[model samples]
Target: MASNPPAPEAPYAPVQPPTDTFGYGGYRTDEGPWEEWNPTAESIRPVRGKHRVAKQRGGGFARSSTVLGVGVIAAVSAGGMASANTGKAPVSISMPDLPGVGSLISDDKPAPEAASALASFGSEAAVAVDADADADQSVADAGEALRSRIMAQAESQKTQVEVKAAAAAAKAKADAVVKAEKEAEAKAAAAKKKAAEEAAAKVEAARLAELAKQYTLPTSSYTITSTFGQAGSLWSSGYHTGLDFAAPTGTLIKAVHSGTVTEAGWAGAYGYRTILTLDDGTELWFCHQSSISVSVGQKVATGDVIGRVGATGNVTGAHLHLEVHANGNAEGIDPAAWLRSKGLNP
Candidate 1:
């Protein structure tokens, strides 16, 4: 039958497993690594239709593996870069409040590109903090300037008030001085008035004293025959009640002191009489006249004629009777003593 296949070649040479002898493990040659064995169409038969076709055409499991590996590496690199950029916390910053910043930050509305550029460069909280810091600094500087101005104004006002107070105090002191001076002037005027009154009183006293010195008795300088207090009865009643002057009748009579003659008329027991009264309280009576020459209330001087010497009715031998009374009372004292009391010699 086809020569019977050359006697079947030793029972198909007893098929054996492949072995590795070189370090490449591609072939089992003992001297060195050999080329890896690849089967050709001339050596092997083709596989079944679709599975074999998929291997020769391009898109296979190997291409799918290469694409999946590249994608994995790219994703890993992107994630690592983002982590590096995001890890550092922002540096600390101080700021003042910005206009509309709080609204822009707290609300969901987005700002314009100009605004958002500044806004997004920092965190929303960081934006608020920067704006607030700048605003706070500006406000503090403005406040300091305003405070300085206010303090300066207050100091100026205080100085003005002090000046006004000083002026007022000076005015008050001047007014007080003027008032004191006026009071002193008034006191001086009162003192002068009082001194004038006292001086006038002294002058009046001196005038009254001088008038009493120059009066004498109204007779021929008669000697004392019967004094004012001789207590013996000579003719009538109980006592010699009249001062007797043993003078001739019709002797010219004179006034004793400057006075007014109250009466020059007839009397029953003392015939004719003249009554005279002087200022400052002294009374004189010339009794037993030969004739009457004066009437009531006739003014007379120290040496003027009032009436003649009298020796009528109850008189002995043409003698004159004289009487002196104090304050219209008939009480008697020594006539010579009373005349001396008036600074007059009888």
Candidate 2:
């Protein structure tokens, strides 16, 4: 038999880099030179200067999604490899150390150096996202607190205004009540004073009405030519001591009140005189009369004719000279005043 053909290689087998320990190697294949690469802290660090990564347009969402998808794919590949080798003897598989090739491997500690850097980048991105969310929540909470404070202040102001208005209204009502009470009191006082004055006037009127029934005038249709207390040479006294009523000759004179005739006769200078003594002992002298109509000691009623007017005692004209002596006193009082006391005008 012909010698067995050389074992066929898998089409997608990983290419191994040349075993060189220094600088760059010039290993070539159909795709390109399989350059050797070794990961380091400096090589894995993010590029700066002119070779720096450009900033993403929208946000970090695309970067985060890419990182998450890579992690998921690595985890799934690791799980599949573990399952496939569950009952097989351990075998050593070699892979080339090439530029950018470490990122595609799935292992327990996948791409050791590069994985650590990617994890650091993912952690920083997560931290940045968390910090932004926290900032947004803080601002929203502060705004809500501010709105609450404003509402509380508004309510407080409204309450104060209502309280003040209520107080003002109460004060106004109280003032009105006090003013009304004062006005009522004033009206009551005025009414009381008016009633008292009217009552006093009524009593005075009643007293005068009663006096009118108990007395009578001495004569009528006569003119008072002279008044009591008149001063002239026509009287024997310094002043007129009686009232003078001048009338036509022979006019009748009447008794002023019910009384007894104490004297009824002509005396010197008294052409015809009559003296009436009342029950109270007051004497009424009617002098210078034309004639006496009653005798001495005769009882006469009020309004009874007692004498006639004539130009008699110290005569000047036809008139009656009437004098009043209270309580039998010889000195006479004003006849006109005494007549008024008994409810007569004159």
Best candidate according to TM-score: 2
lDDT of candidate 2 at residue 79, scale 0 to 100: 40
lDDT of 2 by residue, 242-333 (tens): 88888888888988899999998877776678999999999999998877889998999888898888887788789888999999998989
By summed lDDT, the worst window of 10 consecutive residues in model 2 runs over: 32-41
Error of 2 at 25 (Å): 43
lDDT of 1 at 220: 83
- Give the RMSD in angstroms, all C-alphas superposed, for model 2: 12.6
Task: Give the worst 10-residue stretch by lDDT in candidate 1.
Answer: 14-23
The per-candidate count of clashes, in order, stands at 14, 1
lDDT tens readout by residue for model 1, 17-89:
2242111234333432222233234643544565522231222333333333334333333343333445533
Error at 172, model 1, angstroms: 72
TM of each candidate vs. truth: 0.37, 0.45
